[model samples]
Target: MSTAASTEACSTSRRMSIGMLYVDLGIVTRPQLFEALVECARTRCTLPAALASLGYL
Candidate 1:
């Protein structure tokens, strides 16, 4: 498979694994979990200070 295809497959597997882990740990929904992840990720990016001012921090 191509690099992009492999990367996509890996991401899907990872999400499935994490979803199951969350279910086992009693997380209620994917939206809440992924939203938290996205927000957490935003904090670590370059120029995150701008986002912080925009209330993304």
Candidate 2:
């Protein structure tokens, strides 16, 4: 892959890992994580910020 594509892939993988970690640790439910992801995309915010906004953080 191109350098930019590789970097983007790595970033996406890392973000997915973090979200899964939260679920694994019982910090958030899978559905909550899904909602946070949607909020993250809609608000252009990070996952943590989205979680906090959703009163999960």
Candidate 3:
């Protein structure tokens, strides 16, 4: 893979890791987190922003 592709993959995983951390910590349910992820994709928003919009944070 190219350097840019590798970097993008790493960044995407890090975002997912953060979301999982929140789930594991009981801050949000898996469904809620998945909802936020979907909203984030649709809105092109950050995960934190999506979580906030979903009232998870």
State candidate 1's TM-score. 0.48
For every model shown, what is its TM-score relative to the native structure? 0.48, 0.76, 0.76
Model 2, span 1-57: residue lDDT tens: 899889766765776789999999999999999998888768867889899999999
Residue 40 shift from truth in candidate 1, angstroms? 16
Model 3, 1-57: lDDT tens per residue? 999889767766776899999999999999998998888768867889999998889
Minimal lDDT window, size 10, model 2: 7-16
Q: Per model, how many backbone clashes are there? A: 0, 0, 0
TM-score of decoy 3: 0.76
| Candidate 1 lDDT, 1-57, residue by residue in tens | 999889756755665576556656764355554554455345533223323444433
Candidate 2, residue 1: how far the Cα is off, in Å: 9.2
User: What lDDT score is found at residue 37 in candidate 2?
Assistant: 82
Q: Which stretches of candidate 3 lie over 4 Å from their true place?
A: 1-10
lDDT winner among the candidates?
2
**lDDT per model vs. reference:** 0.51, 0.87, 0.86
Off by over 4 Å in 1: 29-57
